[model samples]
Target: MRNTPLIEAFKENEQDLIRFLIVRLKSAFAAQDLAQELYLRVCGLDESFAVRNGRAYLFRMASNLAIDHLRREARQAELRDELQTFFGDEAEVATPEEALISRNELERLERAMAELPPLSRRIFYLSRFEQKSQREIAALVGLSPTAVFKHLRRVIDYLAAVRDT
Candidate 1:
């Protein structure tokens, strides 16, 4: 407690840290969240930890957090794109007939999914709806990641064929 210079440094540079994160993250809301996270991390550090420069350490942590946030966002976007590509485009507006056709297709797709083996269906659900990575699904199902991907591909191909007809 007597030698916690990092806390003093953090108090002096808190606003500057927020501004720095905002520039890196491009959102004031995200920046504020990251700043709060940074503070929590600093608070968790051992009291006897040595640091030559606390401000530098804080800014570096902020930068790394921003990068990690961006990476997670990118991964989510990729997942969305994968699903969008699989399901095809969505029309913002649709006529009654078109809506009915889409609903029918959705029902058919659901039926086709039900026809799949339980493991394949589970993998598909985990990957698509849960937004889990293939490795994560594999770990859950006790299969290799490659096997999980194969399951997803098989189900997707089957669903596509069913949707076409």
Candidate 2:
């Protein structure tokens, strides 16, 4: 019923929603694509939609979008692999191990970040990488300073876990 709350909730989860889709879809470029798709779906939502839990509905839309993406990727990869096999003689050489390693690490970070509960991950990224202060990020993302600090601690713990791997 409250458009203000709906908009606020949507904005708060937007980054993580995009991140989740992009990571699963394996292309940050697709982030915009998926976001647009989500908006298209959400725009059609109605009165009953307004009354139910907004976050769950939004995520259900996201989850369905993700499924479609995964199916498309599977089909594309299969066709690409087959095409590459037939064109093996013209195929590019493999990337260097270091390059591959760096790529893997980037993907790993994305995956790890994606694993985090959305709000925690958002605040953590904004603090560490975006260089936002706790107060600034809290104001922007609708969290308290204490919540931001807790998120930072959780991020540190998660990074330590990744390093241990």
Candidate 3:
């Protein structure tokens, strides 16, 4: 690095870096915020200016922090979108509020089903929802009654996955 003052280095690189951040972040305000955060970080370091790639380092830190922020925001947006999409998927006269609750319960059941193990899923589908007996499930799956009971026990473990915790 040259004898350039850190504040000057910050000023010189700020616009280009903010533009880079804006391209990825899709907002002028967010780019400006991240760029300022980068400048502050560089100012806060205790080490002397001896970097081989100062610009790269500043951009790398900003990108990582920005990505973390975006990921958090995206996850929140996904949850909100999920709520919106499922809020009115059933019959009218069911009431839109009732429809929303029904849809959410069905989604919860679907998530629980997805989390089930293969044998547990089979046993569950065969027994409860499909109205098959444990003996019939055992016969179809080629397991004994006792083993079927064991499989059912494991299947109940999936119920915990459905719970909110």
Candidate 4:
């Protein structure tokens, strides 16, 4: 095992690093992941590189990672809010005819979903409304991930055909 000064220091303060990250991120799991990332980063540094203070360097790296994670989370939250506002606000500006058409289309889609096999419908609901990953849906439904994908695909194709008609 190659032990650079930074890597050795990182190993020594690993638990403290995780605690610092957990304080910043408020997620022990995220803190663990960030700590792992920090270790990988330090390991990739040149062995010849000299650090006046290895612990400070590691803490700085961890802090930067936590800040980046928080910024990314904030950006995603903003995007979700934007999407909700865009979709929710659109209804207010819709003309009566457009609203009626949307309503009828929704009803048609519901009926088409109802016509689907129970498994397929359940898969579609889980994938879309519940925002579950295919692997997660597979686990819940006692099917392979590929089977879950196929079920979702069938539902999408059926809905597309209905929309086209």
The best candidate in terms of lDDT: 4
The lowest-lDDT stretch of 10 consecutive residues in candidate 3 is 1-10
lDDT of 3 by residue, 1-165 (tens): 333455566677888888888998999998888888877777776556556667777778878867866865776787778876876575247778989988997888788888777888898877765556678789999998788888887777657656553
Ranking by TM-score: 1, 4, 3, 2
Please give the range of 10 consecutive residues that has the lowest summed lDDT in model 1. Answer: 1-10
In candidate 2 the C-alpha lDDT for residue 148 amounts to 85
Tell me the tens digit of each residue's lDDT in model 2 across 139-163. Answer: 9999889988988998889877886
Lowest lDDT sum, 10 consecutive residues, model 2, at: 1-10
CA lDDT of 153 in candidate 1? 90
Q: Which ten residues in a row have the lowest lDDT in candidate 4?
A: 85-94
**Tens-place lDDT digits, model 4, residues 1-165:** 588888889989999999999999999999999999988888888888888999998999999889878877876788789988888855467799999999999999989999999999999988876567799899999999999999999899999999777
Query: Candidate 3, overall lDDT?
Result: 0.76
Residue 106 C-alpha lDDT in model 2: 80
RMSD of 2: 13.9
Model 4 stretches with alpha carbons more than 4 Å out:
89-165
TM-score for candidate 1, please give it.
Answer: 0.54
**How many steric clashes between backbone atoms does each model show?**
0, 0, 0, 0
Model 1: residues >4 Å from true position, as ranges? 1-3, 90-165
lDDT of each: 0.88, 0.76, 0.76, 0.90
Better of 1 and 3 by lDDT: 1
